[model samples]
Target: MRDGELLAFAEEERFVREKTAVNRYPAHAVKFCLEYGGIDITEVTSIAFGWNAQKYAFVSGGSQMEQFYDSLSKIYSKDVKTLASEKEILLRFQPERIESTLFQALSEVGIRVSKKSPTIQYFSHHHCHAASAFFCSGFASSSILTIDGSGEETCLALWEGRGSQIQITERVELPNSLGWLYSCFTEYLGFRPYRDEGKVMALAAYGRPDTNLERVFDKVTGLVESFPFYRVDPNYIFYGRHSYGRRFTDKLVTELGAPREPCFEVDQVSADIAYQLQKRLEDAVLSFLRHTLAKRPKNNLCLAGGVALNCKLNRVLATEQKEGLFEGFFIQPLSSDAGTALGAALLENYRIGLGRHVPLKHLYWGPNFSNDEISGVLRKSGVKYNRVSSVATEAAQLLSEGSVVAWFQGRAEAGPRALGNRSILANPTSSRHAEAVNLKLKRREPWRPFGSSMLLDAADDILIRSEAAPFMIQSFLVKDSFRKQIPAVVHIDGSTRPQTVTRENELLHEILEKFRDLTGMPLVLNTSFNGLNEPLVNTPDEAIETYLGSDLDALIIGEFVIKRNGTSPSDLDS
Candidate 1:
C-alpha cells in the first residue's frame, strides 16, 4: 500500500491451504507482498496492527475478568481458582508479545528483522473496519458502520467519514453485539458459527418465519422505537458457561428448543429460527441506519465488519435507501477480520499524508501467473492442451453446451467470491449444470445457489433495481421476466448475487458476450475454484490439481484449454 496504491494483498489462508489459518502469523502473505513489491523487510517504513491491545485491556476491567472466570467455571462444571496476578498477566496485552511472535514467524520464512526494526502502530479493530469501507468508498462524506463478533471491548461502531478523516460517532460494547447474536443462532442451527454464517443466510430463504419465532427473537434481542439500537439480552449470551463454550445459554435453548446437532439435517424449527433471526437483524440494522441518517443526513453509506458480508441485509439497505438519505452504498469486499489488515494500512497511509480518495476499482490484487509460467506447469504435468487464440471464446463455447469449465486467469480475487478469475464456470440457464456442479463437483450443500457474472450492460434487463454490483457482495431481485432464464443462478427467493463484468474486465466480459451471442444469455454461473472447505487455488499447480480432481469437463488456463477424455466433439463445436 505504498503511496496509497495497493501493490499486493492476499489472505494467508490462500497460501497455507487452511481455513482462517487461526492464530498463525501471516508470514507467507507478508513474504508474498514484500517479494511482489521488490523489497526486503528492512525497506518497510512502518508496521500497523489492527488490534489496540492496551485499550482493550483498559476497557475490560476486573469485573469483566471475574465474569469470564465465572463463565469458565460453568463450562468446566466445577470451581476453578487462579491468582489475580495470574489472571491479570493472562488478560494483559503486550506489544512485545506480538513483536516477538512476528519475528519468529518471519524468521522461519527467512526474513530477518531486528528487535525494534520498524515503527509499530496499533489501530482499533472496529476503527480499522470503518476505515477500510469509508476510505475505499471515495465518498467525500458518509455514514459508516462496523459490526462484528468482538473487537477488543467494542463489538460495533458507527462513524462519520470526511475526506481523509473518520470520527467515531457511537459504540456498542461486548454482549450487545449484533454479530454475536447472529453467530449464536448460526451455531444453534448446526452450522460453524463465524465460518458458516453465510450458510444460515442461505437457509433462511427456505424457512417460513412465524409469529411465535418472531416473538421469541424480539424477546431475545429487545427492540425499541428509538436510539441506542436494539438491546441483545446478556442473559441469553454472556451468562454462565454459554459464551465460552457453545456461545448460548440454557435460557436460549429453553426459548428456542434444543440446539441442532452438527450432523442433523436442517429441520423446520431451525430454519424458522434462522428466518426470524435474519428478519430481526435486518430490521434492527435498518432502524439504526435510519436514526443515523436522520441525525446526520449523509448521502453515502459505507459498511464493514462480518455482518456487512450479509448480501441479503446489504440488498435490503440498498433498496430501502431514499432520495435524501443514502444515495450510494458500498460494502468492503473483505469485510471480515482479515479486512482489518487493509483498514490498518489505509489508516496509517492517511496519517502519513498518502491517503487515497478514490473508489476501489477491482479486487485482482493477489498473485497472478504469466502465459509462459502456466505453459511450463502444463508441460511439467504432461497434460494434453492447446494454445488457442481466444481462451474466452473456447471457454464460452464449452459452457454453452452444458459443460462445466475451470477458468483460471489473471490475478486471483482477494476476497471470497471468484469474480471470474479463479472460478468454476457453468451454463447459468441449466439447472442440471448447477446440480452437478454443486453436488458432484464441489460437494457442497445442494441448497446453496451459485452466483453469476453478467455483462454490465445486461444488468438492467435482468435485475429489478439494476445498480452496478461489481462485487458479489449485494444481492438483487431477478426480474420476473429474467428469473426463468437464469434459474441456475437465481435463489429460491428470486434474487441473484451477480458480479457485473464491464469491458475493463476484458476476458470475462468477452466470455459473457460470446456466451450471450451463442445461448442468448449474458451471464454464466460462477463459483470459487476450490473443493468444499479449501481456499481458492492460488497457483497454477493447485489449479490443475483441482481441475483433475473435480468433475469439471474443461480447464482453461491462460490461452490454453484442457478437455476431459469423454467431452464430446459436439460440445466443443461452435
Candidate 2:
C-alpha cells in the first residue's frame, strides 16, 4: 500500500486451500506479496501489525480473566482448578510473547532480513479497521464506524476523519460486542458462528418476526447509557478463553429454547429468531449513527469490520441519508480482519509522509497468469481447448445460450466476492440457472442467492436509488419491473447484490456488454469459481481442476476456452 496504491494483496486461504484459515500466520500470503512487489525482506521499510497487544494486555487482561472466571463459576458452579488453568491461559497473551512468536514464525517461513531488522509497529485493531475504510474511501472527511467480534478486547470504535488525521471519539470493549451478539444468534440457529453469519442473514429474508421472539432479544440486549450504540447482557453470552467456541449461554437457551444442532433443518422458530436478531442489529446501528451525526455532523460515512459485510445492513445505512444525516457512503470491501493488513500499511505510510491517498480503482492486486502460462498448464493436463480471438465474446456467447461459464481472467479478486476474474457465470434471466449451479455445481445450499455483475449503465434501470456498487458489497432493491428479468440474482427480499462494472474492468465490462447485446440483459449471475467449502480458485490449475470436476458448460482462461459435452469452441462463433 505504498503511496496509497496497493502493490499486492491476497487472503491466505486462497493459497492454503483452507476456508477462512483464521489464526494462522500468512506466510504464503507474505511470500506472494514480497515476490509480487519484487522486493527482498531487507528492502522492506517497516512492518506494521494491526493490534496494539501491549495496551490490550494491560487494559483487558485482568477484566477478561475475571469474566472468564465468573462465567465458569456460573456454568460449572465448582471448577476452581479448571478456572485457574483458564486464567493462566488468558495471562499468556503478553505482548513480548506475541512478538517473539511472530518473528519466529516468519523466520521459519524464510521471511528473515539479511541486514538490520525492520522496525515493527503495532496499531490499535479498531483504528486499523477505521483507517482501511476512511483512507480508501477518497473522502476528505467522514464519520467512520468499526465493529467486529472483539479485536484485542475492543468490540467497536467510532472515529472522525479529517484531512490526514483520524480521531477516535468512542470505544466499546469486551462482552458487549454486536458482532458476538449476531454470532450467538447465528450459532443458535444451526450455523457456525462468524463463518456462517451470512447464512443467517440470508435466512432472515424468509422470516417474519414473532412478537415473543422480539421480546426475548430485547430483554437480552436492553438499552443502556454506558454503551451508547447497543448493549448485551454478559449473562446471556460466555466470554471464554477460546473465542471460537460456543458463545451463547444457558440462560439464553432457557429463554429461546434449545440450540439447533448443526446440519439440522432450519425450522420456523430458527427463522423467526434470525429475523428478530437482524432487525435488532439494524436498529442499533441506525440509532448509533443518528446519535453520532446529530451531535457532530459529517456528510460522508465510512464503515468497516466484519459486520459491514452485511449488505442488507449497509442498504439501511445508505438509505438513511434521506433523513439528512449523510450524503455519501463508502464501505471497505475487505472489511474483516483481512482488511486490517491494508489499514496498517496505510497508517504506516501516513506516518512516513507517503500517504497521498489514491482512491481504490479496482481490487485486481493478486497474482496473474499470462496466456502462455495458462496454455502450458492446459497442454500439460492434456485437456482440449481452443485459443479464441476474443475470449470475452466466446464466453458471452456461451452464457447467452444458457451455459454456465467458468470465467477466469486477469488477477484473482482480493476479497470473498468474485468480481468477474475468477467467477462461475450464468445467464441471470432465468431462475433455473441459479438452481442448477447451486445444486449441481457448487454443491452449496440451494437457498443462497447469487450476485449479479452488470454494466454501470444498467444500475439505474435495474435498481432503485442506484449507486456505483462495483465491489458487490452493498445490496439494492431490484426495480419491480426488472426483478423477474434477473430472478437468478434477486434475493427473496427483492434485493440484489450487484458488482456494477465500468470501463475500468475492461474484460468483465466487455463480457457484460456482449451478453446484453445478445440477450437484452446487462447482467450475468456471477459466483466465486470454487467448489463446496473451498477457497476461490487462485491459479489456472485450480480453475481447470474445478471446471473438469463440476457440471460447468465452459471454461474460459485467458485466450483459451474449454467446452464440455463434445462441444467445440468454433461452435461459439455460430
Candidate 3:
C-alpha cells in the first residue's frame, strides 16, 4: 500500500491451486499484482523478503549450536548424547540450498536482479507479522502480539507500535511455541497439524474440558512469566522438528494415552482432550495479554501470526473489551504465512516513510474476470449460459428458492475464508440446507457448521452484537430469537461466523438486500467454493468445472449465469 492506497495483494495459492504453497515463491501472484497495478517490475523501488534467510544460515553453520542446545536442555532435560543428535539434525537445514531454490524460482519467472539493481531488504518473519497487524490496525499507538510456528529463531514476539514505527519489546525464541503446542494436540486428534487447528477449535465446542487433562497440559506446556514476556514449557512441546512426523514425545503420550487415528470416529475421549488443549491455550494467551495490557495501558491491541486465526480465542479478546482490557482490537485477515508477502511490502513502505495506517476494508485483491472472459469459458465448455442484467437479484431468488448457488463475482479473496466473491450460497433458514450442502456439495463432516454472509444493518438483530466482521474471522453468539431462523449457520453452541456485508462489495450487498426482501432474513449461508479437500476456485474455468461436478443447481459468474439441466440462464432473468 502506498500512502494508504492498495495497489494489489494476493496469495500464491490462489493462482497455483495449492492449499498453502509453502516455500514456493509467488511468481504468478507477483505478475498479477504488477499487471493489476499497471506497473512493470523495473518500476518497483525495492523488494523486501519476509524471512531472514541469513538467520537460517547462521543456525545451519552451527554458530548457534550451544544456544540451541542450551534451550533444548532447559526444555527436554536430556543428556549430552541426545542433545548432540538433535544438534546434528538441526545442522542439516541447508540455508544456502533454500536461497538457491528461491532465486531459481524467481529466475524462471524472469525476475532476476543484481545486487546493485534495487534496494533489497530482508525482514524477520515475526517482524513482518507484527507490521501486518499493527500497521493496518489504524491505531495511532497500540500493543502488538504475534504467535505462530517457528519463524527463524523466534516463535512469539511482543511489540509497541507508535505512528509508523514499531519496537520489539520482547520475544520468545524457538524451542518453545504456543502454536506448536496447539498443533501437537491437533495432530493427536487425528487431524493435520497447522492446517486443521481450526477444526480442533470447532470440535472443542462440543466437549467439556477435563480439569485433570487441563492440569496435564499445564504441566507439559504452560506459559511461565519470563520477565519481559511469557514462554511455553519446551519440555512437552517439540519445535524445530518437521510437522509431518510425530509431534509429541513419549511423556505426552504416556499422559494422554494413544493418539487418535485419521478418519476414525471422534469419541468422547478425543473430544475432551481437544477441549482441554483449547482451554489451556486460551488461558495462557489471556494471561499474556492481561500482563501486556496492565503494563502498557493501551486500549488498542493488534494480533497476527498463524495463532491469530483461532477465532475462538479472538472472540474472547474482542468481547472482553467491555472488561477494560482493550477498547479496540484488530486481527489480520490473512494471519498465516500467506500474509507474509503483504507484511513485507507494508514494512518496506513504513521504512521508506510512505506508510499511512489505514484499516483494511476488504480482501478482494486477487484477479477478476470480465464478462467476455466468463462467456468465453462457458462457450468453450458448450454449456448454456446467458448474460443477465440483474445477477444479484437472480442469485438471491435462486438462494431463496432452496437451491444452492455457486457465486463467483469480482476478484477472489486472499485468505482461507471466502467472503462472497467466490462462495457457495444457500438459504441459512433450515437445517436441511446445511445437511444437504455437507452431504451433496462439500462431502465433509456433518458436524461442521456453515458460515453466513449477513447484511450489516441486520447484524445486531440477528447476532448478539454488531461487530465489523468483514473477514469472517471471529464467531459471535446468535441471538436466541434468530437461532432457529438461521439454523444452518448456527453452530451447536449457537455461535455463527459471519461476514458482515456493506457497500464495499456492491454486488454482494445487493444480493443480501434482495434475499432479506424475499425471506425477511438478512443472511445467506456462505462457504468456500470448492468440493471436499479442494482449494477454492480461482479462474472461471475452475468455477465452471466445480459447478458441473458438484450438485449445485446453478452458477452465477460475473454477469453470466449457468444452470444445470435445460434451465437457461435467461429463465431466471425475469
Q: For each candidate, what TM-score against the reference?
A: 0.92, 0.92, 0.92
Q: Write the per-residue lDDT of candidate 1 for residues 1-574, one digit (tens) a residue.
A: 7778888889899999998787788999999999998988887888888888554343444444355545554543421223343255445445667777887888999999976587778898999999999988878888888999888667878898988889998887766788989988888877888889998898888789699887788788866775566788755764534533356777788887778765334566777788888988888887777776687655678999999999999989887774445777889998988889999999999888887864788988899999999999999998787777788888888999898999999988888789989999999886888987976468887777889999999999999888888889999999999888789999989999999999768999999999999999989999999987898999999999988888788898887788886433333321
lDDT of each: 0.82, 0.82, 0.79
Worst lDDT run of 10 residues, candidate 2, spans 237-246
What are the runs in model 1 whose C-alpha is more than 4 Å off?
56-93, 243-245, 262-266, 322-324, 566-574
List, residue by residue over 1-574, the lDDT tens digit for candidate 3: 5454677888777778877776577877777887898876667777777776554455433545445656556655564445555565455444556456655666677777555444556788899998888878888888888989878678888888988788898787766678888888788788988788988888887779677887787677665675434456654545333223356555666677766765334567777787887877787788777776687665678899999998888888887776778878889987998777778888888778777775788888888999888888888999887677798988988889898899999988889999999999999999999987876679876667789999898898988866779999899999899998889999888899999999998999999999999999889999999877777899999999888888888899988888775565455431
Clash count in backbone of candidate 2: 0
Residue 201 shift from truth in candidate 1, angstroms: 0.3
List runs of model 2 lying over 4 Å from the truth: 56-93, 222-229, 239-245, 262-266, 571-574
- Predict model 1's lDDT versus the native: 0.82
Model 2 C-alpha lDDT per residue in residues 189-297, reported as the tens digit of each score? 7787888998888878878969888788888785555447678776666633322235676678778776775533446667777788888888888777777677875
